[model samples]
Target chain A: MATIITKEQQEKEKMVTLVSSDSEKFVVEQKVAEKSHVIKMVMNCCGIESPIPVRRVKGDILKSILEYCEKHSKGEAQEVMEKWDKEYMDKAEKDLVFFHDLMLASHFLHIQELVDLIAVTFAGMLKMKSPEEIRQKFNINNDLTKEQEEHIMTTFGWAFQPI
Target chain B: MEVCGVPPEQDKTKGFSINDNADLLAEILSRLDGRSLGVAACVCRLWSGVCRRDTVWEALCTRHVSGGAATARAVVAALGGYRRLYRLCMGPVLERLPPARRDEAGHVSLSLSLSLSLFSIDCYERLGGRQRSSLLFLRNTVDVS
Candidate 1:
C-alpha cells in the first residue's frame, strides 16, 4: 500500500506584500518571495514592518517572476527543478521582447536567478552569430569605418573561418 | 563636455546607441562562452569596443580553458597567464614545433608532423596571421626535425 503525506505545515504559515512602481500591489507567500535574495535581505533587516517596494518591476513581470519563485521555492526534487527551469527558459525564448523587458525588470529588482537565466539565453543567441548577423537580429546599426572593419577581421581572424 | 548637448544632423535612426542599453547588453553578453563572445565582437565597432573590454575577454578565457589540461598548459605558455592572452581560438597556433629535440636525420619527417600539431594549439590561441615566413620556418623545421 502507498503511504500518503500531507503538505508541509510550515509552507502555509506566512505572507508578505510587494508594491510596484505604479502602486500596483501583490500579496505573496513569504516563502516564495524569500527565494529572491533581495527580498530576503530586506525582510531580515526590516523584520516584516513594511511592505517591500520593488519600484521598477511591473505587475505582469512580477507575476511571472513570482510564479518562478513559487515553483522553485518548493525545494522539490532536484530533477523536477531542472526540468522546470528548462521549460521556463524554453518558453521565455519564444517572446524575445518580453524576455528582454523582463531582463531589465529582473535586474532592477535584483533577482539574480531570473537575471542570470535571461542573460544565458541572450548569450546563446549571440554565441554563433557574426557581427553582421547580430546587427541584423537585434536591429543594431553598423557604423564602423573600412579601417575599423579590417582591424576587427585581422584581430579576430579565428572566428572568421571556423563558423 | 556638456551633458545632453547635441550637434544638429545627429540622426536618431543611425542605430541603437551603445549607451542606451549598455548595462543590459553587458549583463547579457557576460553569460556567453568565449568563442561566441569573440564572434559577437566582429559584429561592428560598437560591439567590437564592448568585446575588447578586458572583463569580457577574461570571462571568455576562464570558460574556454576551464578543464582541459593540455589546452590550458599550451595556452598559458603561449599567452603568459590568461591575462596576456588576447584571442586564443584562431588557426595559426597549430603551425609547427619540431618533434625531435636534437637529431636531424631519418626521423626528420615524423618530427615535423608532430611539431606542426603542437604549433596548431598556439596558432589557434593567438588568432591567425598571414606570416608565411613563420609558417615556412615551421614547415622547414618540421621537415628537418
Candidate 2:
C-alpha cells in the first residue's frame, strides 16, 4: 500500500517567496504569508507563481512581520502565543524607528491584527508621558502656537490637573 | 523629557518618519483614551489635529460607552459630534443636567428640554435594553440629565 497525500495537504505545505523592497527574499509557508490580507489578495488573483514583491516594506521590517505572521498561523495555545507576541513587541519597542517601519508595513499589508497590536504598543509608550516627553521621544516638533497650546490646556484642564 | 533612558536612535535605515504618516499616526492615537488623548493633543500641531478628528473621538466613545456600537452611533448622532458626546458622557453628570430654576409663582420649573432630555432618555432606554453589564457604568453616570 502507498501513502497518499491530498491536494489540500500539499497546498498547506506550499512555499511563497516574498521579496522585500531592498531585494531581500523570504521564503515562507503559503498560509503564513497569507496572514497578510494584501498578500492573500495578490496570491488569490495571481496564483502565487512568482515572488511577490512587497514594495513598501523594507527587508528587516518585512522579516519581522513575516515572523509574526508565521507564529500566529501556527495555531498555538493562547497563553503561549500571547507570551510570544509580548516578547516580540517588547523587542520591537526597543527601537522606535523599527517599530514605526513595522507599523507602516502592517498597515500597508492590511494586517488588521498586527496593526492593532502595534497601535496598542505605540499607545502604551505614549501613555502617562507628558507632551514634551512624547514629543522628544518621537522626535515630534511642536508646531502649535502659544495661543493654541493655552487653549488646549484650558480646554482639557482636568486632564492636566493633578488628581 | 525622555521617558526611557536611551534616546531613540536617528533613523539611518529608514528615511521616513512615522509622525509624518497620517494613517499610522491616527491608528496609534485611536488606541488612546480620553485623558491620554487630551495629553496627546498637546504633543504637536499634527497630533492635535489628529486627536481632534471626530473619527478618533468616535472610536473612543464607542469603545468606552455602554450599549453596542449601534447604540453608541445613535448617541453620538444625537449629540452634535463625538467630542460633544464624549464630554457629555465622560464629564460630570451635574454639568450635563438642566439647571434647576424656581418660578416667580413659587413653583419649580420642570420644562422638558429637547437635547439633553431626549438624549438622556434615548441613551438610558437603549443602554438598559442591551442588558450589558458595562452599560451599568454609563447608566450610573447618566440619569435623565
Candidate 3:
C-alpha cells in the first residue's frame, strides 16, 4: 500500500534556492540557508518562496560556504565541531586563493566565526617568519628607507633576536 | 560605492592583496602578537602604517597587561599611547630586575613607595586587591627603614 503524501507535509520540508553570482543555483534546506546571516535577513524581508540571489559570491565559494553552514547547523558536539572546523580550514588552506575568497565571502555574509578563523589562519602565516620571508610570501615590496627600517629593527631588537 | 571601505576598482581584481582591503588587513594583523607585529611593521610601508595604529597596540597591551582595567588605563594615560605602554611593559626593566636589588630570599623587591607615588588617588583605590597583594609582595622582600 502506498502512503498518501499531503501538500502541507511537503511544505513542512520547504527548501530555499540560492543563486550564485554566475547564475549557479543551490537548493538547500531552509534551516541550513539561514546559517548565513545575509540569507536570513533576505528571508525575513523577502520570504523564502523565491530564490535569493547572492550576487557577490562566486559559485564554487558559495558551495563551500554552504557546506560549512550545513554542517554547523546540525549543532554537533563541541569537540566534534572543533575537529571538523580544523579539518575544514586545513583543506581550505591548501589553496591560498580559495582561502582568501572564502574569507572575503564569509566577511560579506556576516559570518563572524568563519571571519575570525580565517583571520587567525592569516596571522599564523606571518607568525614566525622573518621580515624577508613575509615580504616574499605576500609579494610585498620593502618601501621603508634604510634609516626607517634600521630604527624599527633596532628599537625592537629583541623581536629580531632568536627566540 | 565602497565595499568595506575598499575602492570599487580594486574589488574586481583576481588576486587579493592586503593593501587592497584595509578592514581585512587590519583584522588579520590584529591577531598577531607583539613580536610578530614588530616584524609585520617592517614588511612594507602599507603594513608598517597599519601596525602602527593605536588600536592594534591597544589590543596587544590589554592582552599582555596582568593588572585590571584601572591599571591599564593609568599606564596608558601616563605613557600617552598603547605602543609606548607596550614597549615599557615588555622592556628590559620587567625582564631583568637589577641583581643588586635582590633580597636575601632571592626575590627582587620593587620599591612600594615609588610605585605608590606613580598612581593617582583614583587609580590607587581602583587597584584594590591587586594593589594590596603587590604591596605585600614588595614589603616581604624590602626593608622599610
How high is the DockQ of candidate 1?
0.30
Which digits, one per residue and each the tens of the lDDT, describe model 2 over residues A1-163? 1334576656645988999999999999999999999999999998776899999898999999999999999999999998999999999988777788888889899999999999999998898899999877777778899999998887666667643
DockQ category of candidate 1: acceptable
Residue-by-residue lDDT tens digits, candidate 1, A34-149: 87788888888885546789877877778788889899788899898888988998987765556776787777667788888888888878766767777766767787889888
Query: What shift in Å separates residue B82 of candidate 2 from its native position after superposition?
Result: 2.5
DockQ each: 0.30, 0.36, 0.35
Per-residue alpha-carbon lDDT of candidate 3 for residues A72-139, written as tens digits (9 for 90 to 100): 98999999999999899999987677888898999999888888888988898998898899876666
Off by over 4 Å in 1: A1-13, B1-19, B64-86, B89-145
Error of 2 at A90 (Å): 0.5
Q: Please report, as a residue range, the 10-residue window in candidate 1 chain B with the lowest summed lDDT.
A: B88-97
Q: Which regions in candidate 2 have their CA more than 4 angstroms from the true location?
A: A1-13, B1-16, B65-67, B91-145
Error of 2 at B5 (Å): 21
Better of 1 and 3 by TM-score: 3
